[model samples]
Target: MSMATTATTVSLTSVTLEVADLQAAHHFHTAFGVDPHIRLRASEAHSTGFRGFTLALTVAQPTTVDSFLGAASDAGATVLMPAAKSLWGYGGVLQAPDGTIWKIATSAKKDTGPPTREIDAIVLLLGVEDVKASKRFYVGQGLTVARSFGGKYAEFASGESSPVKLALYKRRGLAKDLGVPAEGTGSHRIILGSTAGSFADPDGFAWEAATSLAPTPSTESAAA
Candidate 1:
């Protein structure tokens, strides 16, 4: 029996940050030109445009670097780098809270410059059991389906051309191609922006959908 092969083209879905204190993190981010928009929630704030991914600050007690590594290991999160003291100061590695290897760091660098250029897009790739069904559901939700490859894959443009794109694919093939071990059904997950609730795809792939607010202008000049 020939196993079906899925294409290997994975786009970034979302990036999230978890901080110890929402207020303090918000203030620090603001100092770096990353202004957080206040919504109805007190502990949550988000950025505007492609500039902001998602920021979450919870009341987790500070753990030693070793403890943090242990927690990540227990959570099945891959450790990109072991925690260690660095020239920049502080120490942390890159690891996803749940398997994905996102960069986790404790930066000691001082804020010496303005914010970088805004992001151009946020890409979302979903791994699904049934691509046809997922496509149908998205279409039913009034989203325009742009590009599709048979019943195996589909892509949708947010219609704004703001660089945010959503796509769905078969789970096993997706995981295989991405080199991510299969973790059962609905392995895809998403982290939606502040307003919209985050969700996981049929294959457990994570995703988040949210309208971005405009950013506040800064008086500081860009860093060299």
Candidate 2:
């Protein structure tokens, strides 16, 4: 008998949120399959802050996108943008109770694939003070740039086969783009998974290297 060894790829699974109501926040994120950490802070006001980031969830179908948006609103997430048809596909945005923003979409021109959760995958869109510097920093961390435009935006393609996508955006620009106030303060209260040692991004978004001892499944997907 012959044995085959498959390689395991890295992904940024969940982004943490520091909220005043941990229980409520957890309930809200449960819709996204995220298990938030229970935390206590020195200042009650400091317990919650805008982390200057938005999550992008991609689904396999337009119907799924619609369903997810409805679910988001029902789960207490405010719809920043309603699901609609666009050049890209059917998509929209949501603002979670804990202040996290999500832009979700499905391919408009392509056929919807397998059925999964309303949010099948996530893209971490970090709003940075400086886009160019942030892009350079991630490149230094061994991440390859999938695409970029002048100093305005850049997407860091994941190394994992089905990895969580990441991107950089101007802080105020992002806030304004999302129809929200352009302000970020206090602790980010978020955790990002990274193959690189745990460290803060140029914008203070933190990342922790993969440390789980569980065996990687042979058919495990990076997108999931």
Candidate 3:
């Protein structure tokens, strides 16, 4: 009898936002309607400026985008870019009270139905110094490339049940898209939940095995 070996693959199972205030972060996310999709960790990690990344939410239509943006604003998120219509779609940018930037967007310019609270996807876009190099690094860590646009962008494939998707973009370009300057220092203040293992990427973003992490937060609690 011959034994078989299987190669392990990597994927983003969840995203953990390290914040200074646990209860406050929980309350904000609960009110913003994103509590079910993310995890929270109490970290007094010294970090400042851009943090080199942004979380993006994709929705069905422009009205949905507005709905999410409104919720975020009401929850105390500072409006970085007011919701507006652009050639690609309608979207807006805001910074959470914990200092993480978020972008809510929709590809549909017109509403086909009444506004919904449904979120189609949550994307974790890392701003890296070198897109190609970072893409190669993730590929080496067992992430299959779902899409790549030269040195400008790259996306990794995740399971259908994945709570979050992963992508890469040029740091300056990402900042420009979010209507902010690119210069940032200190920690990224975010940790990725990975199926592969715990390790820091070349750009300094950290990851931990999903098995070693806490459960996803609910509207009731942020305990991990």
Candidate 4:
């Protein structure tokens, strides 16, 4: 491909959630069955209200959605939205004990088989002030645009080996979708692991090269 058409080769490798209490965060992830998909780091950054982002668990069907949500609740996640059918799909929202908001959802309204505690994909959606500007910033960092809807939303294409997919959405609309207010302050309390070098985006989301040092829990026991 020519330089003009060449897409950057960057891809996401890990997602680290900064939390005040690491042990509690680990326990929560363990209970929610997503410990393998995320890493936890110690942070005391002052933050309040919406954190300008959310992590979503895309599952196969409604039954699976309910199963995950139930596990999250039993693990100490606060329900933000009860699981329900929508025009787009069935899903629910919750806030983890460590203050990270998560949404469990599926496009299939009905179950095709018995329920399973399986997550189809994990998407990190950054609620940004300007989707267009953020999209440009990410593209500059070597992430290829997968699907974009003008200024409203943009999804990036991650390598098949990527542990997580990244996307951008207008802050207000995202807040509404996640059932929260659009206002927040202080650090994002999250770090992205990527092949791209370390830098903060236009909205202050941090990314560090995946090779950076840090010991995290093993993914051996978790479902992929």
Q: Which candidate gets the maximum TM-score versus the true structure? A: 3
Per-prediction RMSD in angstroms? 14.6, 8.0, 3.7, 4.8
lDDT of each: 0.41, 0.65, 0.86, 0.86
Candidate 3: which stretches are off by over 4 Å?
1-6, 212-224
> Residue-wise lDDT of candidate 3 within 1-224, one digit each (tens)?
11123365567888888888889999999888888887888887788688999999999999998899999999999999999999999999999999999999998889999999999988999999999999999887888899999999999998656878999999999999999989888889888877677788999999877742234573222345
Clashes in model 2: which pairs? 162-222, 162-223
- Give candidate 1's whole-model lDDT: 0.41
* Candidate 2 accuracy as TM-score: 0.73
Residues 7-29, candidate 2: write the lDDT tens digits: 33334543344456666765666
lDDT of 1 by residue, 173-204 (tens): 65554444545432112243322234444433
Candidate 1: list runs displaced more than 4 Å. 1-121, 161-163, 184-210, 213-224
Say which prediction, candidate 2 or candidate 4, comes out ahead on lDDT.
4
Which pairs clash inside model 3? none
